[model samples]
Target chain A: DVKVTQSSRYLVKRTGEKVFLECVQDMDHENMFWYRQDPGLGLRLIYFSYDVKMKEKGDIPEGYSVSREKKERFSLILESASTNQTSMYLCASSFRESPLHFGNGTRLTVT
Target chain B: AQSVAQPEDQVNVAEGNPLTVKCTYSVSGNPYLFWYVQYPNRGLQFLLKYITGDNLVKGSYGFEAEFNKSQTSFHLKKPSALVSDSALYFCAVTPLFKAAGNKLTFGGGTRVLVKP
Candidate 1:
């Protein structure tokens, strides 16, 4: 079984603070994705990286950025956290035409 | 652009009974549809996907989904509902023409409850 590890399960941050959420996968999958899960909106893609040092903006990437310094690791950075940014963030990895394997997720709370 | 829709917000069913969750979608070209389930406090788990070939796709945990191209629907089904089957379900889709890194568009999600 593939294991995708998230650095934090729960996080609390104050407004205007910078937040970094880290994810690492063991399968060496080339495609990594970051999504924010909300009550009614389901999961919305925030950012994704297809290779190290390569990233693409998703539908809702206004306040977020991503870094893929290593093939196994992808990090999501919130430049300035706000109350509206409080949500569960998910990390997923997949190979070409394969189903995505996801990490448990990190719940962020910005107050 | 591609879009997925799960019409029902919640579906209540009894154990041992048939379970079905409805989904519809729209996309520019061919659709790559998928179904996922999320246990509480957990990330979404891939249930099944319809890429090509047979319309009926069987997936993990005894879950199956049928792809209907004419209706633009991909509905998930289970022969018998188990209490453990209770979870939040989401239907997702991506355009076939896109590259490998294509991101999926998800529905609002449907919560399933199986009673004893």
Candidate 2:
């Protein structure tokens, strides 16, 4: 069984504060992803990493950045958190052509 | 660009009744389609996928999906619904590009309500 674990389940941050969401996967997958889930907009991709220190911006990468310094760990960074960035942040990892295994998700509330 | 669409926002069915959640996709070449289920406050769980070969793909929890090439549909189905089956389901499609790094295009998701 593959296991992906997120750093937090719920978080609250003040406007303009820096936020970091961490994720770790036990499966040694080569691909990792960050997504934000909203009610009507669905799960929009924020960023993804294919290899260590290799990152790609997704559809909605604004106001978000990601780091994959280590194989098992990936971190999402919000340079300046805003209310609009508040969302259910999900982390996922997978090997090529394989199904992604996702962490439980971190619901962040920016006030 | 590749995209996935799950037409229904919500599906309600009685327990023991067959249930379906519709999904359609658009891709340039042979598409890899998948279905995932998410419980409240949880991450998405893989259901099944249609990569190649057979159109009917069976997955966890007795869930199956049929990939229709003509209709561009991959509708999820189950013989009988259980109350525990109530959850949010998402459909996803993989792009044809190898450089895409296995990123998945996901639908908005459909909420399933199984009533006893």
Number of the top TM-score candidate: 1
Q: What is the overall TM-score of model 1 with all chains considered together?
A: 0.98
lDDT of 2 by residue, B1-116 (tens): 88888888999999999999999999988888889999998999999988889999999999999999999999999999999999999999885455346788899999999999
Candidate 1, residues A1-111, lDDT tens digits: the string is 899999999999999999999999999899999999999898999999889999999999999999999999999999999999999999999997688999999999999
Residue-level lDDT of model 2, residues A1-111, one tens digit each, is 999999999999999999999999998899999999998667889999999999999999999999999999999999999999989999999998788899999999999
Give the Å error, residue A104, model 2: 0.2
Backbone clash pairs for candidate 2 read none
Docking class of 2: medium
Q: What DockQ do the predictions score, one after another?
A: 0.70, 0.66
Best by lDDT: 1
**Model 2 Cα displacement at B37 (Å)?**
0.3
Give a tens-digit lDDT track for model 1, residues B57-105.
9999999999999999999999999999999999999988763765899
